[model samples]
Target: MAVNQESLLKKYISKDQEKQTGQAPRRGPGGGPGGRNRGMNATGKPKAAKASVKRLFSYIGNDKYKLIIVLICLLASTVSSLGGSYLLRPIVNNLVAPDTSVQEKISGLLSGILLMVAIYVVGVLASYGQSRFMLKISQNALQRIREDLFNKLQRLPVSYFDTNSHGELMSRFTNDVDVIGEMMNTTIVQVFSGVISLIGTLALMLYTNVILALVVIISVPLFAKAGGAIANRSRKLYKSQQAALGGVNGYIEETVTGQKVVKVFNHEDISIEEFQVLSDHLQKSQMNAQFFGGIMGPVMGNMSQISYAVTAMIGGILCVLGKFDIGGLTIFTNYSRQFSRPINEISMQMNVIFSALAGAERVFDVMDQEPEAADGENAVKDGVMDGQVTLSDVTFSYVPGKVILNHISCYAKPGQKIAFVGSTGAGKTTITNLINRFYDIDSGQILIGGRDIRDYSRSFLRQNVAMVLQDTHLFTGTVMENIRYGRMDATDEEVKEAAKLASAHTFIKRLKYGYDTMLEGAGANLSQGQRQLINIARAAVSKAPILILDEATSSVDTRTERHIERGMDRLMKERTTFVIAHRLSTVRNANCIMVLEHGEIIERGTHEELLAMKGRYYNLYTGKAELD
Candidate 1:
């Protein structure tokens, strides 16, 4: 069942619909800075940023069980941590207090210890359970994200890949995902811990002595001010670090993958020197961020320590003047010291948030990019595409304004064979791409089955068109699965039949595991001829009416090419075929040889007729033939 063109357009956002560069969408800043504002700051209030924190949860998507359970665990963990704080009060008031009966004191002390132990035990268990649960959720989310990203990569125009680095894209999956995972696991927990500790400690401090608590409360603004300022400074540094890391990774991937080329061209020294600049930048960015942001924890701790010392001294003088008890003074000082823990925790965790935020920004950038070839609404509906294809005044470009195919037009009947031959980059592949709407035509109209191709659903157009490209990619799977990829629903017997038609079944049967032999990733274990044979088998299984073979045998040996040529001849008979090749010998028998040069059809005729004219085809054949 083919999806209609209208539906594809409706589902896909066009390349033209992309968001402008620079300004990014706002997600939540949660866990710190806005703990109370766990959800969005939806109201038109002064703290609108706080509202976005709530939106973060919403952005992750709502579910019945997954999120609700996580929320429940967060609440349970916070409660347990807060409950532990109350035990501290009992420990201070009973065991350390004078004028307490032995029996009363022992009971108080034991109860406090038991409460602390209980909360600690439960909290530990809760943390472990929550960690495991969050991992499952993160993994599920990561898996969904990775799948979507890869699918997007597949659908994107080849031009996009040409412009982007494989390493940079791979980082989105590896580094960006790891960043999200670390934040979800560690940063979120620290935020929870800091918040619970802060609120519980503040409440205990006020209860113990309001006057001293006011002093600590005044210090809260100091910590926040410092953290906010440092966060602003560190964000740029952290972002630079990530950017530098990406560059280095990109450089390494390119260098290693093209190492053979580098050695042949004697480019090692220059490449290494270029890589050092990025590596050095990465080191400096990290050092700057950590040195600047890393100083904050101790600075805030010193402020707390100073406040603690001052309070204890003031309390000591007051106690001597009969104003407060020594036990009360101790608790006051202890609470002041305790106050620093959460504040310092917040200050230090800002680095993690910055790093995670940077990664999220990168990940989001990719997620927000526009699809290359989205169809229009109310476009063509899906069918077998049983009509002839007619191109009229069509022009196109992989890059705008530099037309690869200029004012080109052709028409082929349902059963006619169309062979394309020309110099490389003469727009042969680009022309084929237009047939499937891989890149929409810059100008002119293409009719499929008497209807405009744009009107036909993109999937329907693709479903009927099967291409056996020169470079065939095989997924990591068994020999059977590789062939079955042509049509997933194909049975073993059907797959074997296709292999036989492609002349690939003979070698496949001789393999150690036959059809079931598992292949290395990318089918690296197979020989070039074997891989091409398997691809041919795949194309045969598709049984598409409109077959496209783009130099299918150009990469194989002469013997292998002959074998494929025979198989292809058998396969293409009576089917509408488009054969693109640099080898003039293969297409000598084509129904029509459409010669292209600089994107325009220079000549079109049968091989004998073209040879009679002694045109480009004639000279190319005579020029490049074995000449033996």
Candidate 2:
């Protein structure tokens, strides 16, 4: 079954917020289908391990020369280690032979010890070089992976963000990528070295005594069976643990961000209870995952010990029967132990390998998603939009067979103020979304400047439009810098002028450092009204010919709204504007008012003309009926 990470995270956050605050959770844009699965097979193994590994290596391939050096170092280190152990056979033989004098034996022992010491010194240097080069290679590969992931996110459609939890996406960058890095740094080298050492040890064991080598080889199946079984169980558990961890992380982020809401509704206790459930789930999953993973070491060790004991008893018998020299029996027993050491090492590394593969699969899952549709050939790239927009016979849906806008048609001439007022879920904001090309209409023609909207590059189309949404967001920067964000090249004087037009200049001047004061955490230092004013100011500086204001004035008071309206009147002149508001009075002077009901325009006229018609707009305005 596929894991819906966003739903898992949202379930905890929304459930608590809804029960205590009497507010529904915000759904994904378009109320579309759930997210894709996490790419796990029925046995809990990564569905595309081979593909993921191939792609991961592609990133590492960029540093080919450094990787070559790391490989050479690994070979050098492994050879030195094996060579030093093999030398023990001759050294023991020369030291214990019955014909050797005491003085000769002491000289032979010192010479042999010196040779082994020299080989070990070389091994130490090679090991150090291997670590240094591999670290560089791993870091370079990780940098590229992170860059690609971030770049892909930038090109994704807005709908993607709506459907996926922000915290889960962040985990891909942090925890997932971190595990991949760890494997590259240590596990990759260890596995390669272990394989080489195991092969070399087996060859030496056979050269010393074929009987002993056969005995050691017989234990190989036991190692494989035990390791495979443990790995299979732990793999599934680790995947579960990772999913649970993502959920807990996402919930904590949501709760911290919305702590004020929790306190206001006195839902702290409920929030705690919900958090406990997620936390407990994570703990149990981790406990099981670690238990299975941890046992692979001891299980392999015990089996190796049994194999070693059997090999030693047989080697001792061969020595007593004069079929093997004392020195050969001693070295063969040592080689037998050395043979099992690599097997044990590789078995123990299975957990790291599984973790890294799972992480790589998750990261690749995002990279594999289709990005926003590319702009067509011959798409307009360099022209100012005339601000004329029209939708004809438009049909749209966020999900299949569930139309949100049905056969909607509308027209706005250049420099016109078109206002849409309707009950929530009546497609008020959705119309503006279509105009901005945030989503494509299913079957219809949306024209801008008398040309099909799809004829323009998405970036070029958006460049000419500015939006002020209901929720305000400010980057971590000074107040002046935030306003200037609307237009990157705006001068300081232009920024201040825009702030004045939004009625924000006076309050900005009252701040401790005025316009230069730094704002962080999305402008937490500012009041809601102040933050909304800054957002309006941001739109004012954009100088785009087309503007969208969705609940832009809902956060401000009547007096402040009046000030904003007066300023907006100046800004809106000679520009096309679309307004979505709940307050009927706000659209009174609009050039045209569109009253939508069930995704269809039920009334179209000026505010006064609609009020005179005694229709839906009339009832809504006179308190004769509620908007909902």
Candidate 3:
């Protein structure tokens, strides 16, 4: 089976890589789809490279003073380095010339040696100062960039996370940001120093002998053309490589998180094959990008060597003929070597620069996303709420053109328990989502306390409504800390009281260290019923006026479910409660029950009334038909 899957993966990837499809392999139907389609090449509507680079530099805003100091140091360092080499000419010529007196030659040699040492000392100090300043600037700019990216993520809409994987977002924080840091600290310095060295050497060469300098200048365009072509290819390959890397990480995380299911279903072979395919794809992209990028350095170096040989031959001829002085020839030879060094260095670093830019563009693209829309000025700020909720002709769709909730109207008075019973996909959980304003309805009004829910600030509405989802997510903290997450300011006594109210106190007492016991892996160390009880305890501690229990008792055994139901009964009093459950017995005593099908409410009343109607709800309650 592994062999067969491997063959299939190979076939898929061969075709996939050949076209360079310029896109990642498609994810499964309900998986986290790629969200970076807009600016990256995946969308085919990529933003201009230069514009993104310009914006990335804007993150360095307000550090201009440090940058200015760094620039001054850089200039001083470059000039001193060149001056040391330039001084070699006079030092040698004065000692070698036959017409000079012994005393004059000795004096010239000593003075020139002292100046050379002084020049080197100045260069070392300037270089050190530049490095110190750049370190601070790079770290500070990166710090600000990371802060903005994180802050933007918090404000982004839920729809964003729906489409993007946790791994992809994490890559921005880890891999991409690290690349940017490398560029700022190392690549930027190398390029700046290289360019200054190149230009200064070329100028000196031209002053010493124009003919030799012309030979060096004429060969430069060839290197430029080669470097540009390689850069283009590497840019595409690096972008593809980064995307593939993110895909691989997402797949690994998914498989690891669901490892039990994979083992139960005997899917090990298929999983390995798929992972191999992704890994192979990444290897191929990296190989091509590195191959092309690596060629430029050698090609530039060879070109420089050829130019150096030509200049050496010409300068020797000019010196012998007395057209050029020996000192001038010496400087010209060194300058010729210096002239091509920058081109070679820049060629070698093109790949690093390209990658940093691509990563920065991705980070900036996320920062540029439209954040969750803020509430209007009339939004409630008083933090006061009564437990009244009404859904007036609410309509909504997660996907356009496919309605999930259709003109559903309902009401719940204060202190009422309203239960929603429906087949899966009947918008039961969506209703709770709407009340909390996780999503706004298409054409309807949701009111809390006789006012539009939209009129309340999102934070305020959420504070008033507490929800316990089917899947409980507990952080890596003590039991006490997890319960207190519901109400940050709640005292330990209050948390324990909430736990007691939710019937979790009995279990808490049995556990070692009681409330202080640490939980990990979303409370994986605990039983399913225990986790759900903790979840209920979390909601109990919230002290909200409105509550939502979504299949909260479905995962537990009959005895545990009874305990949970009783705890919920106590929680439901004096609050407007919304319950969604698969078990019919859970909703039997509700003040009202609404049965829904195909996005519309089809039945309403108590359980006895629904049973009397002998409608879809009756069929479900009687077990004649299963919930889809």
How would you order the candidates by TM-score, starting with the best?
2, 3, 1
Candidate 2, residues 1-628, lDDT tens digits: the string is: 3344456545633321112111112243555433333323333544466677789889988999998998889888988998898888888999879998999989988999899999999999999999999889889999999999999889877666665667767877887888788888888888878888888888888888999899999999989999989988887777666666666777778788999999999888877877777787779878888788888989999999999999999989988898987788887888888888887887777677767776776677677656788999999988788888888989877655668888888888877889999888898877878887878889989998899989999988888788997678999999999999999999999999999999999999999999999999999999998999999999999988888889998878888888888888888787888888998878788889999988989999999899999999999889787634
Ranked by lDDT, the better of candidates 1 and 2 is 2
The best-first sequence of candidates by lDDT reads: 2, 3, 1
Q: Write the per-residue lDDT of candidate 3 for residues 1-628, one digit (tens) a residue.
A: 5345455433333222222112222222254332223323332123446776677678765599998888888888989988898998998888889999999999999999899999999999999999999889889989998999999889877666665667667777777788888888877777888988888887887887898888888888887887777777777776666556666666677788899999999999888988887788778877876777788899889988988898899889988888988888888888888888878888888777766776776676678767767989998977679999999999987665568899999999878889999898688988888889877789999889999988888889889999998678899999999999999999999999888877789899998989999998889899887888888889989989999999887776777677766776787678888989999888888899999887899999998999999988899999887544
Where does the lowest 10-residue lDDT sum fall in candidate 1? 28-37
The TM-scores of all predictions, comma-separated, are: 0.82, 0.92, 0.92
**Candidate 1 residue-wise lDDT at 151:** 78
lDDT of 1 by residue, 1-628 (tens): 3334343221121111222222122211221111111232112121322332343334444334765566566657666766675556567767767799889888888888888889878877776776666666656665666666677667666545544557766776787667666666666656766776677778877887787778778877877887777777776666556555665667678887788799998888766766665566668878987776787787878877887887788778878887876667766676677678778877777667666665555555565556654677876656467637788999986554556798888888866778899887788987888887766888999887788887777777777778887678888889899998888889999899888877789889999999999988578788877888888788888867778888776766776667776766677665677889888877887888999989999999999999998878888889843333
TM-score of the candidate numbered 1? Answer: 0.82
| Regions of model 3 farther than 4 Å from truth | 2-47, 626-628
Better of 1 and 2 by TM-score: 2
Each candidate: how many clashes?
A: 8, 0, 0
- 1 or 3, which is superior by TM-score? 3
TM-score of 3: 0.92
Error of 2 at 563 (Å): 3.2
